[model samples]
Target: MSIVDALDRVCRRLDEIRACVRWAEAIVREGGSDAERRASNEIRAASFIAACGAMEQFFRAFVEWLCGEIGQSGLRYVEIRLSLHSIASSGDFRSLQSLRERDPMFGRRMDLLNRTVSTKSCSLKVPRDELGLGGETIRPGQVSNVWAVFGLPGSGFEDLGQEVAMRVLADSRNDYAHGRVDISTFLAHPECEPSRFLDRISALEEWCFHCWSAGLEYLDSQGYRR
Candidate 1:
């Protein structure tokens, strides 16, 4: 899928989470038993968790889409950024070493090295594992690292003004998931209210929109090519 499509999916997911938040709001507004009120707070907490999960999925999809686009762009090895070229050629050390061990004749090894150093036309599809998102939470540093893979500056999200929201969402999600904070404690925090959660999530949506636009602009300019 394209980055735009990924963004659309995330937006829809966030909207669903927002709906849950609204439902929780309704429960609070109406007179409710103690049990019902507690349930509503739990719903809000779940919504926050869902929002973080949605954002994580969006980033994963975006990176996968980017790799597919670079592969399809048909640009020569030399035309792309050096970091991408490195990933396309060397990949991880285990794979590279395995290839070397298998190539006693050195023919395959030499050929691979030549491809790396020369301006040969080759598949530039980066493997998802090479992108370094190994089941970790999506933080600002992770976002920056992903951008840096394509020669983009790590400060792009900061420039877009969503860094704090991204950090907060990731950290809060981690805390909740790890049981560092219970739902009641989470709700008790001043910034952890359902409304604040929605606002942070809205900022994330804006971040995704900017990323989509920027990805399209990069493709249009053939930024991957010389």
Candidate 2:
């Protein structure tokens, strides 16, 4: 999908999370009983988890879309950054090496050498995992790693003033998912209030928008090509 389309999907997902927050807010305003309060807290925690999921989905979709665009840009392998080429070739290179070692045949070794050379002249097609995004949470560092692969500075989000929000969203999600924090404990944080959570989520939405814009700019400027 296009970056704009990917971004729109995430924003819509966040909107749904915001609706959940509103539901929790209504419970709080009703002077909920202890059990009801607990339910509200759990709802907030679930909202946080869903928010993090939205961000992660966006990151993965954006990266895949960006890579697809790069591949279709008619940029030769040699024209892109060496880091990208290396990342794109890493899996193939490892597979070739493994095959050569298993067989210990001259032909296998020669095939490995030929594939390595051919990679330099072929069109660039980066593997998804080349960005080190192996199903981990979408934290600031992970976001930076993806940008860096496209020749952008890894600190792009930090520079754009969205790092803390991104980090909090990821860390909080992990805490809830891994049972590191209970619902009560998770809700105790100032940012965990339904309203405050929405604010943080808004910041995250801003970050995604910036990423989409920057990605389009990068492609338009031919930054992916030398």
- Which parts of model 2 have CA positions greater than 4 angstroms off? 33-35, 93-134, 153-155, 158-161
Kindly report which residue pairs in candidate 2 clash with one another: none
Give the deviation of candidate 2 from the true structure as CA RMSD. Answer: 3.4
Each model's lDDT: 0.73, 0.74
Mind giving the per-residue lDDT tens digits that candidate 2 earns over 117-142? 45344454445555545466788777
Residue-by-residue lDDT tens digits, candidate 1, 10-88: 9999999989888888888997888988888888877767887888788878777777788777767767766676667
Model 1's C-alpha root-mean-square deviation from the true structure amounts to 3.2
The C-alpha stretches of model 1 lying farther than 4 A from their native spots are: 90-113, 118-120, 125-134, 158-161
Provide the RMSD of all predictions against the true structure, rounded to 1 decimal. 3.2, 3.4
Clashes of 2: 0
